[model samples]
Target chain A: MRVLITSGGTTERIDDVRGISNFATGSLGKITAEQFLQAGHEVFLLASETAILPEAAENLTIIHITTTDSLVKNMEKLVPEVDAVVHTMAVSDYQPVFMTALSNFSDDFSKDDLLHFSAEKVRKISSNSDFQLMLLKKTPKVISYIKKWNPQVQLFGFKLLAGVSEQELVDVAQKSLVKNQADFIIANDLENITKTQHEALLISFDRIVKMHTKLEIAQSILEKAQEAYHG
Target chain B: MRVLITSGGTTERIDDVRGISNFATGSLGKITAEQFLQAGHEVFLLASETAILPEAAENLTIIHITTTDSLVKNMEKLVPEVDAVVHTMAVSDYQPVFMTALSNFSDDFSKDDLLHFSAEKVRKISSNSDFQLMLLKKTPKVISYIKKWNPQVQLFGFKLLAGVSEQELVDVAQKSLVKNQADFIIANDLENITKTQHEALLISFDRIVKMHTKLEIAQSILEKAQEAYHG
Candidate 1:
């Protein structure tokens, strides 16, 4: 089977010099990609430019992505060719419309005076700037577009929630799985994640498999995806 | 001589999971620190947690910091003890006050509705958000405060500017150097920097040294600081 695995976090440009990015390191995705390659599967690793990567191999193709725009383009290009997608990339929720420097955070500030001229890209707002406002527009749902792009491709979605109950995380994961028409959902608790531990619940439509470590999770995911592809 | 070095890019939190950061990799700083260490200097490296770091050594003390607040705190504590400071860290200019979900980016919005409650770290906004406006107040000038922290400490500052003339870059760096009371400022062009090349001008009050590579830049900076310390 061919797999397109995404890892790490997407960054939305605030300007040529600055950006907003999430905190996904793509370590697990790198590990998962390795497991697939060991099983002799063709792997297209769609990863953040800053993500941890599996070593280059004959069966492994790496596509480094940055913003949500780049991610959309790459996923659209690869989703049709691959048999499955393990999307671990934490894609940004918003894209910048414009950024304006503010004088203060005072309540008396006028909305008409808000935009303050968004730059082309240079954002030469001087190193001497004080206060600012950034207007971010919601990006399209990147995951939902996967099934729409390739309905037959199996999808394994990962959801990270912090300070939430076990049941709540799973329920949210379940809903997301159904909504996205995914074959599996990995419900991850942010609180439980550390350098050593990455406890997660692998939920299918009918079953839940518990994973305690990143290695365990990677092996299980690789196996489950293989089972579905061959079954 | 004892030298304090700041490296990488500081992150300003938008929420618990999301943040705004700059593009510095801390690669140059790491290279510079190694040069200093090879020259038998005691190095105090205050770095962004995400930065590329020098390997641990008995003479090297590493302090990993995240936000602008942490950077300020660390600089204040370490400045008085060190003989010189090489500040290469890309600190954030603004910090988030609060974020509100916008139905749309229409100008019909009200400033009265501008500040949605600043969450206590856990930003539990639904994943189904449409739009958001983040108000960011300017952080205090970190470099200016450094000299105030320790009046006698020789300072080597790094300034990055994109899409600007060489003269403009130097002029700004010169102003920053004078304003911050830095002994030397490395004026860097964003366009000239790549994996192999790192064109920079090391500017002091009366002299400028041109450097064309990261290693060359590192060597020059180390020598200049050593000269100042010995003189």
Candidate 2:
């Protein structure tokens, strides 16, 4: 199978020195990619800056991504060919509409105030669009694009919640499934996810199964892919 | 207040190359620690061996931990003085029953003839109690120790669930509140955690509030801590 996976949290720069990113280390997407490779499937990976690189695979292609626009651009080209795409990266949902020209960035600033004239400052600077404080726009939901780009390709998306119960997860997962047209959504318990090792529940349309380890989850996904392919 | 927070999953070695771990990346614990520090609390952190560091804190002590025994040992000593203890690390619930002695690990050639070992020989070699599969004893519950060590100190714990509804989360959180005697339990959805960047909810005894960013969650925690301190 031609499997494509995205990992890591995209950073939206508030300024040159600071930005917004997610609380992630990129272990899931990295390991999931490796697991797919181990199962003898071709893999394509688009990684944000902060995600850890999984062990190199002989049949895997890696793409470095920094913004939602770039991601959309790459997916425009790659999503058509792959059999499955696992959308794991936390894309910055809000970004600045544009960036300042490089020349406007100062090496040394004057302590005293300088005269300013107001002219409309607008342009497409997708570079630092990930993090902006005041004038930000809701990013294109990548999953929406996947469904639009390739109707036949199997697409999976992730959802997270804090302090909701098991029944709440199923409701949310089901909603996400129908809303995004995802084949399956892996519902997780946050306490176990961020603190240490915990189990995960795979919620599909008809059934739910608990998997205790990442390997177990990956293997199940691989088997599901095989089923999807053979039929 | 002085505090200690542990984050991330510990790898329990089963052999030279294999070990057991979980999907957790240590974000929540780290975020909490950052919030506590932001509130001007002195913090000490015991972190699992992973690539990510604990959130930056001005008043913080960091201890790298590997085994369940070591975690208990460290806490037994430190739990006495801190005003609050947040045990967030996903310590392995089990460990290898035995360790193989290096001298006994011989790989001499035996392909030419049938490989055989007498029952007595096998028993003799395997009976070393220290090297015998070390049956893992469950680690002491951190809250139990906290309550025991300092009855007056405020205590908190988390209960995470997957594939459950919001009502289930509240039910689970309430049960945990009574059973664990926790001052508060931040019940949460896991599938929505590591990947979802913006949405988080907090469940206390009387209410559930959804927060849009990690910063807001930290702010809520700080407010709760202050309320507890003042009340």
Candidate 3:
């Protein structure tokens, strides 16, 4: 079966030289993809440029992407073809809108008084003035469209919260799962996670399974996905 | 002699998870540090978190840092203690100043209409608005302070320019050398660089040497620095 796994953090470029990225290393994604590959599945890993990649294999195909738009484009094209998709990538919530020079930044600073420029045109933005204004807009949700793209494909959506309570986390994840029509939601807490131990909840339609390690999480997803896919 | 090497690209944080970083991987810095260590010299490597680092050794000490302010603090503390310094880290030119929400973004968005907040005070920014305004300010030059911190330490400053003529590149490198009072300046062009090969010009008091590889650059810096120090 063909498996699609989006791993790592997406980058939002401020310019050609500089960009904003999250803390995701894609190691967990690597493990998930490897588990599927080991179980005789064809895995396609859509990874960030800075992500920790798994070893190259005959069955594993890697596609490197930077920005959110590229991710959306790839997802829209690849979701219908794959049998299952584990959306683990930390997609950026926002993209740069426009940049302008704030020459006289005060109570009277208005859009009419601003001179905005496209960040793409400038290779390296010069920080010559008192304040260089950068405007950002929300990016589209990549996971929400997975079921719409292919309703038959089994989907696992990841929800990471900084410091929310267990009930709050599960409720939010459940809402996300319903809205996206995903089969499973991996609810993760940032505070309890460390290098050696990962605190995550495998939330399904009726029950929530607690996972203590990254390997366990990968194994659970692999086992559960195949079981549901066949039966 | 104790040699100080600043390698890698510094990350400027917009928040806890998201940050801006450059393209420098610190491979050249790693090579340079390795060269100094092989010659039986004490090496202090001040590197960014995302930088490629040299292998561990008895004489090699690594210092990891992020942001311009942290880099400055490290530089001030280490520059006075070392005998020679090779400044190669791609320091961020700008830092985040303030972030404001642009609710009714149009031809008449004003500062008073803005609700500005500190990025550090918030966990994750909600992109539910039309536009989020991020203001940035110029970062202090760490190279400019090396000499002022310790006038006796020999300095080598790196100047990276994108798609400029050789003469233009050299002229800019010379200007930077004079401004920083660096003993040597390495001029680099963005267009002529590749993963396998690097194009660099080593400019000294009276002449310039062209280098085709990262090894050549490291060797040139090592030989030149030692010769000047002992002679």
lDDT of 2 by residue, A91-144 (tens): 765553332322332433221111121223432122222121122345677877
Better of 2 and 3 by TM-score: 3
User: Under CAPRI classification, how is model 3 graded?
Assistant: medium
Candidate 3: where are CA atoms >4 Å away?
A: A104-120, B104-120
Task: Give the interface-residue alpha carbon RMSD of model 3.
Answer: 3.3
DockQ of each: 0.51, 0.01, 0.58
The stretch of ten residues in a row with the least summed lDDT in candidate 3 chain B is: B111-120
Off by over 4 Å in 1: A103-120, B55-58, B103-121
DockQ, 0 to 1 scale, candidate 1: 0.51
**lDDT (Cα, tens digit) per residue for candidate 1, span B153-231:** 9888888887789999889889988898988999997888889999999999998999999999899988888888889
- Positional deviation of residue B18's Cα in model 1 after best superposition, in angstroms: 1.3
Q: Once model 2 is optimally superposed onto the true structure by TM-score, how far is the C-alpha of residue A116 displaced, in angstroms?
A: 18
For model 2, the DockQ equals: 0.01
A1-231 per-residue lDDT for model 3 (tens digits)? 888999999988877677878768898999999999999999999998778888999999999988888998998999999989999999988777755556545556556444454344666665567566787777888898999999999999998887889999899899988999999999998887899999999998898999998999999999888987787
Candidate 1 structure quality by residue, lDDT tens digits, A1-231: 999999999999987777989878889989999999999999999888778999989999998898999999999999999899998889888888777755444445444545454444555445455556777778878899999999989999988887899999889999999899999999988788899999999999999999999999999889998898998
Steric clash pairs (candidate 3):
none
Please estimate how well model 3 matches the true structure, expressed as its whole-model Cα lDDT: 0.85
- Best-to-worst TM-score order: 1, 3, 2
Highest DockQ model number: 3
